[model samples]
Target: MIDLSSARLSRRGFLILGTVSASALILPPFLTAEATAANRYQPFSSRLSLTINGRQRQLDVDTRTTLLDTLRENLGLTGTKKGCDHGQCGACTVIVDDQRINSCLTLAVMHEGASITTIEGLGTPDALHPLQAAFIKHDGYQCGYCTPGQICSAVAVMKEIKAGVPSHASSSLIDAPTFEPREIRERISGNICRCGAYPNIIDAITEVAEASA
Candidate 1:
């Protein structure tokens, strides 16, 4: 016969062993089931009001949806590119209250009452914004996937410069705040153009800076 008395563990040790066994049996199912249920649910449909492109727009959107998704999928504003769903790529950059931000990183629900300006709001074919026209003239883009974000970022960069925002490359020796190639490149480095059109993109910003001066 097994020596039950000799094999017996202390009450605390037995409790710990039983607790571990119970956790192993229940934890995995609870986590997996919760995640699966969350993924399967449709977007929460709630009417959201936002000011986009200087106009008030109202739409029903999922509370879990990102601002980029609401712009592209719900509002049909596809000018903001969705290069990477994550915030790593600046392709989804937009201006919110004069500050440039990645739309993909923000939720649509959070942008309520905020003024948002996307690529579509930047310029038109006939009256292109200086940055947009410069991009076209200097061939600042390649496959055109990152053009919108680049242009938007370029515009905001200028605004920042005009407001005396110093970049990491700023020289302490320089008497005046000169937005040279380094500053422009550093400011816009977040937006990656896979086609490798950095030179032309810099040139476009230079042209706009010159015109603005």
Candidate 2:
């Protein structure tokens, strides 16, 4: 048998319990909602102004958005393919400030006020860039999923060679890197072509390099 007589709570204890209960009930719903919203992950937007393909573009994008997503989803530049968003495949490659980067690996918010160029920026339907023309002439792409990245990387590779940038394949670190087949292959190793159009790609890049030289 329980001692019901001695189990009674004191007046002070009752008052404390009542106070807690009242607090829980009297709390405004909006306050609770605000607290919940604060704890939850919310998408924050940031204003971005960058030059894309020689045109100034301003957009409000989520801070977490990737550069690839900004170009494809926000800017409607779908030419930069998204293959292996993990940055393994170079389909998401783009040129930023004359440097080639995997757009999928970079956040859009990081490149504010920067100059960016995508595959579409490289050429038009009527007049093609030299690399693009060479790709078509040599059949550098089969499925063409990786063609944009390949062409972009190829353009950078030529620029790097012209600027005397030494690559790993270069024989002399101090001397300028030559546009040898091995050097070209080594430089573009990051780009993966599932259709195995490597030979044609190399040929196209080689043709462009020679013509520019």
Candidate 3:
């Protein structure tokens, strides 16, 4: 008894009805499949080989797994922190093939034959990297989650500066990248310190840089 001609459906109403109709049309076969096939589908896996902390490693990982998960779950290098897993926070930063990267944004299978360095590789109880010692000396550890990534990024940042890679500070300052505090700040901006230890962190990096220079 509904009057089709009298039904003045607005654009929003039309879209809603269309969506319902499309879902009704498409969802039956998808939902009716065996529960194992539909719900328990396994992601494809690939064999990956990479060097970690100066040790060779081989693992079979699900294609969907990120390098961060591979390090934490499979190879068990847990120093790399995971925050804002979409690559925004830079907490899961690690050095890959001599360059720093957000491990959460990259799949493990993509880095076959690559070299990775985590915070565990940096130092030990007796021996410490200069940056690590500087971090400790300058009181740079606050809550300690971001320190690993911060240190890793700092190590790579200094190397990048030494290699003449321009900092975000300015084009005119490219030649003297390591000498300025602003250049170091701009370079390590991607690594965030939620505990607000930035002043001491900068102090540590500056001391390390000065000592090395």
Instruction: Estimate, for each residue in 1-213, the C-alpha lDDT of model 1 and write its tens digit.
Output: 978689779999989989999999989999999999988866567788899999999988889899999999998999999988898889999999899999999989888888999999988989899899999999988899999999999989998888987665545434344578877877888999999999999999998897896
The digit string of per-residue lDDT tens for model 3 on 4-93 reads: 678999989989999999999998886777654758776798988899999998899999899999999997788898889988878899
Q: Pick the winner on lDDT between candidates 2 and 3.
A: 2
Give model 3's TM-score versus the native structure.
0.82
TM-score of each: 0.77, 0.80, 0.82
lDDT of 2 by residue, 1-213 (tens): 968578697989878988999988878787989999889987899999999999999999999999999999999999999999999999998999999999999999999999999999999999899999999999999999999999999999999999987776645433457677777888899999999999999999998998898
Question: By descending lDDT, how would the candidates be arranged?
Answer: 2, 1, 3
| Runs with alpha carbons beyond 4 Å of true place in candidate 1 | 1-43, 168-177
Pairs of residues clashing in candidate 2: none
Q: If both were scored by lDDT, which would come out higher, candidate 1 or candidate 2?
A: 2
> TM-score of the candidate numbered 1?
0.77
Quote the positional error of residue 185 for candidate 1 in Å.
Answer: 0.5
Which residue ranges in model 2 land beyond 4 Å of their true spot?
Answer: 1-38, 170-175
Maximum-TM-score candidate: 3
